[model samples]
Target: MAMQDLDPSEFKTQAPDAHGQVSTLKELGDEMKAKLARLGLMIAEEAGAGTYLQRDQTTSLCSTRSKGVEVLPIRQALQRYDWLKDYSWVAVKADTDKFTRDAASAPPDVVQGYFVRGLKGQVERAPVQTCLYVESRSTKQVVHNIVIAEEGSEINIITGCLAHGGIGRAMHEGISEFYVKKGAKVTFTMIHEWQEQMEVRPRTAIVLDEGAAFINNYIALKPVGSIQSNPIAYLNGDNSRVMFQTILYGKGSSRMDLGSRAVLKGRNTSAEMVSRIITRDKADVVARGLIVGDAPGAKGHLECRGLLLSDTSRIDSIPELDAKNPDVNITHEAAVGKISPDEINYLMARGATEDEATSMIINGFLSFDLSELPPEIAKETKKLVDQTMKGL
Candidate 1:
């Protein structure tokens, strides 16, 4: 169904036993844990600093293993800390869209989502893992997440979203807000694994303080009915920096519109937006990036690359740069093309079969540099990418 035809009120808001409690990921059934593992969750050992899980419209797990950070359900956090009101719904307005309105209008008792905070002067050694799973068919899961890194602190997070493999159809809407305080750093990696009939929409906004840094990595390599996401970051403090990297594989008849924006409002601040997309079958993909420099000494760049693997598939790369100040430096570049015959022929001449050469090229095309991610998360991300490439 088209987005305009979707009625957010038609889906059930509650599922039976969805609020059941679990102290650890191992408490979950083997089948469920295996599914989560494919989506980048560390289920075998407690290797992460924290873990949060939301099943359907309720929280099933929320725990933190480190004293430097705190992880709790959104509702509990809101009730425990009055200062949270200043940050909640501030980065992203609650009335911005219908999905946001749906999540905002939920009753207090049924509210679902996670709240994560990193204390001042502390650095978490492992990444915090979170998951939003849709277990009931035709269910609409709407959640709001907040993440904060206090001054001089550092943290890494890995989040995954997916639907049950057996589910015929479902919908997911998520709103996320992030705050990086002065001299703090935050690394966020998100992986999406959805069924063929799932529709996903995510709204996100981030703000940075003086000397703060934010690195974002996104990976989506599965069949889905449709997905539309555009996350924006604002560098409001002097010397703050932000970088966004996205990797996508679109197959079947899936439709995807993914983009990122950065507003450089502080002197000496910088931003980067990079994307790599591959499409096959009858898939339609649009990759977009924008950088706006509003400060005198601001610098920014935007890049997008696309590869078409099937004759019927389509890819559109749009890269834009806006310099509002005379002294600012901004640039952008975009390219969309298919595998070159010369490169394939050169590989074949090196004693590789045609099929083997093509596979090698495709694998290299989709590979990403995971050096920025935490060691454990980097390992999981590499495994996930290898598994996704096997189907191609």
Candidate 2:
């Protein structure tokens, strides 16, 4: 079916019962569809070719398109529909099979299906942005593939995943692949917020060619439930570089295992990873950052920190640095602890409530190293973090 023919409302359906309240899956899906439609309308109304091209599954092959910056508004598309708020129980067996099938199909599409599918050629020397949203209930898995190629091309992609309301017991798996060619650069930012009982697993992989660069920034604020994320990057060409930044906050019964790894296989390649996590109530979080420098002239560095807000809260940081080349430089550091009473007292003396003082200190910790993100996204993330902490 054509992308335009696919109505957002058609995909939205009421979620099954979970706990006592209604879920948000249907509402969120409808919102996503509307946002996508609005984005397409905006692109057409603006009538700017080089600056943007909005095509949903419709536009045919066109190589004459100039290499210029591109922007995709995914949240705007989702906003078109009402937000979904609740989900029903999904079997674990079915969810696992769906994920396995999708991964098995990815290799063929990546290797030879590119030509057969009549995919658009590389966007050489231009920046492109794409946004994505997914809403599912009853054990559903989603697979998304992304690729950017050609020399000097630059792309920035942002993705957001949110549960409609509260979930019973469901599993969500997402896979994304990025290919950066010689002298190319790609920056990816992903944000995830789920209901109290959902389980989310997100996996991403990127390959950087000669003189190519890739930067990834991820934020997860799920105060309840479980989330596991694995972000991997490979430097395959000379002078390639990769940087990863991650932040996670967990509260109540939430558990998260989030980390990133980089492998340096070429000369003059470098990788850096930095992450911070906060835990409260009975929540537990395990964060790992790994850098492997195997070739001469390779460099790698990793840093991670965690905050434990309650006595029952748990956090673990495992940073691994492996360097086979004597000329390579590798470094790693980690810390885990709680808020200092001195700082809390300092704020409380200034007429701030205990809860307010704690929230401000914790928020500051998560936002301190996030200066590279867009102001709008960073602000939203901070607000979410503050809201989550309030429930603690």
Candidate 3:
């Protein structure tokens, strides 16, 4: 069956269990967790790495455990959510009622937000893993997240979104909004895992204040039928900065289009966007990006590159830039091509089989050196990258 274009702004509401009846957490046995663990790689050894949020059959959050962050259901956050009392560096709260009143005419189906404050140049981490399970065919799950960083504070957040089911189809729509206040910084990393028949689309909007910075990382290597999204960022304050990086792997008959855009609207602001895509099997992919410099001292760059592993697959890179001010600078480059056989032959001559050589070349293409990341995040990202070209 052919999949139609999906709107990331809307999705179906939560339903009852597979049998069409309401079920409690006590009914979701350990066996379900083990089954989901296979798809998410939530193993026993990494149990204490970060917070785990497992969604079996609803839009509500089902927290498994936490390390240094608080986990709450979206409904709970709407009414009763708070930050850690002992943690003096941050303040958090939420009000779903206000959100509903504000969007009274056309309210969102799933609205969730959290407030965060950084304590005077201190750094904190808020990592999350989200899993969605399907009991019915073509299940749609929509989620929205709002994050804020107070002045002079810093925070790093990593998120993993995954889905799995024995028999049924699933779809995910996620929207995220970020506000980086003056003199503050925020870094975000997102990874996705889904079944071969699933679909996913995530929308993102971000704004930076004076002297603020936002770094974003996105990766998706799992098999899914269709995925498409383009996030936007606005650098609206002086000396503000933004960086967007993406890595994607397309498999099966999947169709994936992903990209990000950055706007430099403030003096002395800068932006950078880089994307890498790998398409195999009968997959089709397009990498798109745009950068705009509107202020006198603004600067920006955008790069989009793709590698195809099969003659039957297709890939395209689209990079665009716009500059309004004579003193502003913005540029873009795009390229799409197959792997170089000469590089593979060199590895093959070095005592590696053809498959091993190909894997090495692919890994080299997708690898990103980040010595400043947290150990656990680095480890998990490496695991995903290593698994990208395996069992092809």
Candidate 4:
């Protein structure tokens, strides 16, 4: 069906449960909207027309696992708000056949908002089953403006994008503007997986305010083509902090570009970035990190590591530290190589096949350090990563 034909009104919005319990989708969307509206009101009251001028740009695409799933076009949900006309962000998910053929033939509504529009409280979170296929073949773009309001308010968002069939190409561009008044927190998590022929490129920008905290985590495994992502965070408020972590694995002919960055502009601000990448077969992987301290008492740190399972596989690491303040503390570390021969030999002596040994070692490498996550999420993430590594 054409994107324009899929009416948002047709999708039933269920009422609250008997006890006034909010459904998953409604609760998420409403919470995001409330926060966004609060920030919009503040901007309108404080800066008047000038508040609208500071919006950011974003664009994105996804095409690896599109199959027999309902690919909801974001434009439908966005049209509900008039403020979106000034900025644009577009995303599409579908299977290979539908994406390459039907997607290309779909009406212009599917591809509209290429460069102009703004998005607010556009939140979607759901526990997608493994069978729902989504694909993005054509190039996609998005420009987004995100704002967060005052002390004690918080916004938490979670999303899982997966493909259970065929392969395709996808891209994403995102920008977030945060106005953290006094003390507030925003936590976001995005997880992705694709078939052997998919390619994905995702970019993000985040701005932080005083006494606020931001935590973002991205996990990508078993992509058939190439997966590249850039996550940037700007700490513009004193005593604010940001934490970012990325985990990725590539096999077959796949490649991955994964990294995170933070810029500290206020005193007592802090940032941390950690990453891990695994490459097998003839795959190539690159992990980059950067941390900048721009104000007195600001602090930053970064670490990245890559593991190569095959002699022909390749891995690269680029870590940077830029500091303008003498009192600031910043550090970084990078490593690129393979599993130790001794470790492999030890596993082989225990009667494990080379492949089995390699898989076990690789799983162990990615399993550690997830202790901080809630038990349920950590368990699910570990299981998913293990399943993805079996293909290697």
Candidate with the greatest TM-score versus the true structure: 1
Better of 1 and 3 by lDDT: 1
Full ranking by lDDT: 1, 3, 2, 4
Candidate lDDT values, in order: 0.86, 0.57, 0.64, 0.52
lDDT of 2 by residue, 129-183 (tens): 2332223454443334434444776554444555544445554555555667788
Q: Which residue pairs clash in candidate 1? A: none
- Give the 10-residue window scoring lowest on summed lDDT in candidate 3: 87-96
Highest-lDDT candidate: 1
lDDT of 4 by residue, 3-108 (tens): 2232222212111121122222123234333432322222122211111111111112211111211122234425664553333321122222222233334343
Candidate 3 residue runs with Cα over 4 Å from true position: 1-4, 7-11, 15-75, 78-121, 126-136, 349-353
In model 4, the runs with Cα more than 4 Å from the true position are 1-150, 167-182, 344-360, 371-375
Instruction: Give the CA lDDT, 0 to 100, for residue 355 in model 3.
Output: 82
lDDT of 3 by residue, 1-392 (tens): 33334442243445423233213333444755554443333531234322334353344333523333344444455455454222211111122222222222223334332333344555555334444444445556555555666777666666666665553456765556677889888777677766787676666678788999988888888778777777788889899998888888888888887888888899999988888888889988878888888898899888777888788898878788888888988888877888788988999899999888888877877887544455555676676677655755
RMSD (CA, Å), each prediction: 1.6, 11.2, 6.3, 13.3
**TM values, all candidates:** 0.96, 0.68, 0.78, 0.63
Off by over 4 Å in 1: 1-5, 15-19, 43-45
Deviation (Å) of 4 in candidate 3: 7.0
**For model 1, where is the 10-residue window of minimal lDDT?**
1-10
- TM-score of candidate 1 against the unseen true structure: 0.96
Model 1, residue 199: what's the lDDT?
A: 79
How many clashes in candidate 4?
28
